[model samples]
Target: MSETRTGIETNPFDRDHYDYSSWFFWVEASEEQKAEQLAQQEQFLRVRPDSSIGERCFISPLAAIQVETLTLGRSSYISGHAYLTGTLLTGPNCTINPFCVIRGNIRLGHSVRIGAHTSMLAFNHTITDPDLPVFKQPTSQRGITIGDDVWIGSHVMVLDGITIGDRAVVGAGSIVTKDVPAGAIVAGNPATVRKWRVPELAPPTAASVPSSGPVPSGGPVSSGGPVPSGDPALAEQLRAFDQMVREQAEEVLARSWDAATGRYVDAPGHAPSVRAHCDAIEVAAYLTGDVPSQLSREEHVAWLRGLQDPASGMIAELDASGHPGPRVTDLSVDDAHYHVLCVGYALEVLGSSLPHPIHAVDELGADGVIALLDSLPWRGSPWRSSNVADMLGTAVLWNTRAGTPHSAATAAGLFGWLHTHVDPRTGMWGADDPRSGRLETVNGFYRTARGSFAQFGLPLPHPERVVDTVLAHAQDARYFAADRQNACNVLDVAHPLWLAGRMSDYRQQEIRQVAARLLADALSHWRPGEGFAFAADSGTGRDPLAETPGLRGTEMWLAIVWYLADLLGVSRSLSYRPAGVHRPEPAGSLTSQ
Candidate 1:
């Protein structure tokens, strides 16, 4: 036996011996880093000193192997031999089993349980070009968000850029590659719904079932799947009305292209914009039809062909070049990020419209879009905030469809890049470097800003920290005073406030009060003929007070209205109780009835 550098013996018959010296160096470095990491870990644990813990918790011995950031919730047990590194955020009453590897930026909702040996990683390396080493390329990381009451089975791997919705269950050994919808049970390599949590079924009752009747082809079916004794005239009338709307929508979509181009002299006004045409096609295709209406199909295909920029395989906002064309506004035609976003939207609409599976154009489809997105040097570009966020949102939607590893990595990178730029004190994002000079203010108000960043789905980076930041800013009565007109600054306040409301009850009462006050102020500015108007006192003059129904003011008002309604509904539900209430159950246990 040949003696190795570490005094370990190599197989005597082997011509080449293993490099034990290098291996020893790696081991030594790992040990030294582990010690330093432990010290840092202790520091973070102390920072959250007021956190509560529950009884009968089990933390594995292996969990102590790496001394990195780990936070545990009350009554939560972490099994032995699990490896947790980087920031781990857990809510009350959770369980994590043995031999799991959870690394980097993780947030777990209440009552979440991870079965044995699962891997949850929030960071990935770029590997598009084999010539360049993976490490040399940028590394991207995001927070892994597991919603309330989620049950992840043994040996499952949930990668970055995924959010497991509330009450979702993941089967053992499955790899989740997309957002698992709420109340779903997913399993498989790229996990898909094996079964729905709540199966769709009509209510059953003896009286509801017909004793004996021939099932009518176009009539309502009873509980026993027999035709019910109902007026056929009503059904016929409803069907006719539905058909009329479908036909009208189809006709509108079909004529959009010609109407937009002014090809027919008899047509009134210029042809509709590309976006308008595509939007109409989408509505027509999905609207109550056994087969896609002929007009919907023809218009959809025409829009797809027209949007394609043949020269670069990029989709253009308008047929003409440059921004602010006949229908297209903002962002240049050659803007890689915007083009990719438009392409993703177009493809998604097209994909949903098709009755059967369509083969993706391998070299020039999603892959090409990803390539163009990654190629753009966003590190120091002037349009990083709006443009990068848009591209990232599109990439998330595309990756959810395609499930490509590269797409996932790119999405994570974009989030990681955005996370770093978030103002530590205010939880607001500024323009990224290289483009930093272009932005007049770091976190200034801008129209079309809410959806721009809000499109990045649930479980944002350092969510708890973000929540704290927003609460801190919001509570400073100065920001919420009746005279304050900055409430319309969606990026700096409204969007973050909305996100915080979704996460936790940290400042639930305060947020509700502030939201109510803001709504009252907004209503004061509402004009009778105009849909909604921007406050005259609003410091930013970028948004013009207008009655245009589709303007930014209208969109922001709708979003605010939805947020308030959702919060009120949730509050009302929580207030209800039986005549005499039993012991309170964990919040996570509740699911949609």
Candidate 2:
């Protein structure tokens, strides 16, 4: 008999219909025939009554799960027609639906649900070679790790090596490529955080949720909507300071960004700094209105596009006009990582505007950015605190927006490793140098690390200790190398001050006073007509420093102080008071290349 005569005619060649459940649709059968089918399914089952499954756990007769490598807690069930392989573990009350292909090393916390048609694989292929077929490529066997109470929706693809945190929901059809922070509600092709799941005990407020504005740009200031924190006085200050900063930033843009050449100028006698160009474009796009008339968005997009190596998402370290250059060999893993972030930020700022569609800045989108991040060199050790912090922070931000599943466990693991190196008294992790033992004194890096942890929703083991160290340092006259304002001290001072305002309730008042004093000390160096000087004593505090009419670094500092003040003063939602949004701190100048 023809298959169509026996059942609904379905193409056997369809990959989508190949799961174990396809048996049912392949033939239409009467009730008596269905009973025989069920019996046959049960007879073919590999699971024994003595298997690891607990009492009251239901495995549908039609399901085909490999019993030997699987372990299920009490009351957990696998829906019918699912094909599962590899070492799988699930806690109590878990529900895995049919047509799911879950394989390799996988773990699910209690009350987890693996929706129908969801596919999660634990390994990936390396296709870097041009000559070889992809299947012939080397494979990487990194597993998937999921936390308790997670809800994965149907049609979701949880890629290899990704981690989904507890209480997190993977929206239907999201492609998770990186680690997801706990309690995040993410949805998209490359998942981005739609909102955070607040604890039941917490008061209802718009904390951590994006403000309804022209578009969601991550910063203290809301360009179109109501100011996030409703403080009229601070709002006034922010407006005045934001205007000043915009003007100075515009000046930098005019001088640095050459529309014709698509290159940012550098200090005399060297290549135009690729890093500087990207940083300026990102900050400019962020600070300026969605469609600023000063420069064409298309031009900026074209410039960024020129830098990309299409085959690989790697951005060149030098522009066409740049000389004495950073050839491909000179491009370090660190440079690539930072530039990728810069590009992502620019795209975010560009795409997030009202009425204006998310224009693709270059061939590279969020996925391209993820590719760059994934390509970073893995250094195993008591890992470098800075690298770990940077990677984790960047991953969190990217995953929150892109919906890519990076590993949350991987980030948490790195954080745990970082915790081991922390100075208990200072609450600061040490420098990257392995030899720097317990006695090594804290430096500016401590402040940056603290900020990264706070921004990324990671706890600073002992924040008060770090705050205390910062406060003590600011009180000393030697905080600035020679009482002259420099970028280093400005940032070192700004990070803690900003954190205190943004993170601490009781210490806000104290931190504000210190910040005011520091701001005053730095401002005194401003030579009205000449703008802020690099150094007043004519000493080079940072290498190759020079006096200039305008410096991007200095402008960044003044703008940050004003922005932080506004942020601290705003009457924030109760949600933000506990831990502020994951938005990048403006004074995170240390993050600059």
Candidate 3:
């Protein structure tokens, strides 16, 4: 076996070995230093009842293993050429192999084994300028704390400011850039959780159909097959309508694109919105096919690169010139949700080639986005409006689409969080914070929430109860204004219809009928030159509705059209964002295919 002079060696029959003599030089310790190390060891052993310093523990006579500020536990052994600084505390039976570099404050619990050639850096550089050298950049320090029974394998790089929890196993050659939970098995370039050392649960099985209860009456119950299109003429008409909407959507989206910056403008000469830009990409892709005009596609990519915020791992709004604008900090839940939605959509649309501002999402990919979400200040609330559900669901949907490992596991975690905050009586989200007032579910919350859940068909806790309450509200005359007029902003009607049709499995017949009625009413307004009118008055569908003229409500109106088409059985085109976006089937029958 090849061995260094300090007695650290490669395993028997392993010919490969690293020469540590040059960098791992042993400076001869003075008699005083030797006395100090021995004295400290003796004192530690005396004070710690369970501690033991094993016989013939290798402490090189010439090696610079600083004895001060380090507390050794029972039978703990550190091989030579391991440079350690600051205050380090090790538990009993800890084994630190050779060529391990540690700095700043560190705490290792019982039986922790740090493998060979590992580096645990507690201070990391902050690289703000690409032009400047990393060495010249400012540094931030956060100590490392490894819990008991943790095993970090060979050639691992643990970056600054993270904790490795108890019983965790960090795989060989991993780069640990984030905190790890207890009993996690992590690996990769920027280490992600491969699996949790958790108790296995029973696999999910198909839910049993209710044995004796009849489905609520209004519309027909699901046939457990494709929704049949009885009227082929209506199907053709709907297809033509969808095509027209796509064309109009394209024209509107084209105006939103800022070629120089690649960002989608909120309005003329206004700052670019993260949500709008991502949404525009999907619109462009769906309308023009996946391969948008090469120039437009390139510009879209540039917008993604320019809008990303490195510091917070968020994609922020940007000025017309491409400079980062207002952040999500202290923003409303709707605004903040939009920012997160933008990131998820980008990953879904751009896939692996998405740019990295600080290499946050790009470095660790989906895990990076998860980490960014974790850092945000948003909290669980049952009454906090449906945007919360949309945000959570979007993250889950996009992450799943990105082909990230353990996406289901991550999504389950978010769903659990959502479940805990739901109001038991109302079957909707309620405020979790005691000081916060009850916020009503309005302002497009129901549609957004319903659309989000419908996208992935993920299981939600107590789903039946929630569906019952929502249905009751939909049937109440007071809920839709005194006259219960379905005609309003086009989305008000189209949105609920899409939500109703897509979620038919869980919804009541009354809701579906209402949605169908609203959709028909909205469609009646579609005009040859003016397009779908924004509203319908007493028995008359008004084209170029007098309220809010000049393309007002046009953007959301197109979104509504897309959602309705999705319910009508259209293949989802890549030109739209996920979660809130739906796929249509069964044409006018409004059923999934």
lDDT string for model 1 (260-328, tens) is 343211112333343443333333323321112344333444445555443333443443321223322
Best by TM-score: 2
Candidate 2 residues 1-593, lDDT tens each?
11222344666553233133333332443455445534544453334222245444555555766633455655666766777865566656677788788876566656788889999986667688989999998654445656656799999999875667656788999998755645667789888667766333111344532222111111221211222444456446446544565455555555555554545643223346655565455444334322233455545544554554443344546656652234232224455545444554443333211111111222224354344333533222222334434544543443322222333433444445556656687766543224532112234344335435544433456666766766666665544534555544555555544443333333545666665555445545544333454444444444344445333444444444543343344322110111111133221211111
- What total of clashing residue pairs does each candidate reach? 10, 19, 16
- Top candidate by lDDT: 2
Task: Tell me the whole-model lDDT of each prediction, alpha carbons only.
Answer: 0.43, 0.48, 0.47
Residue 59 deviation, candidate 1, in Å? 47
Error of 1 at 130 (Å): 68
Q: What lDDT would candidate 2 get against the real structure?
A: 0.48
Sort by lDDT, top down from the best? 2, 3, 1
Please give the lDDT score for candidate 3.
0.47
Candidate 1 TM-score to native:
0.39
Error of 2 at 530 (Å): 7.5
Model 1 C-alpha lDDT versus the unseen true structure: 0.43
Better of 2 and 3 by lDDT: 2
**Candidate 3 positional error at 132, Å:** 57
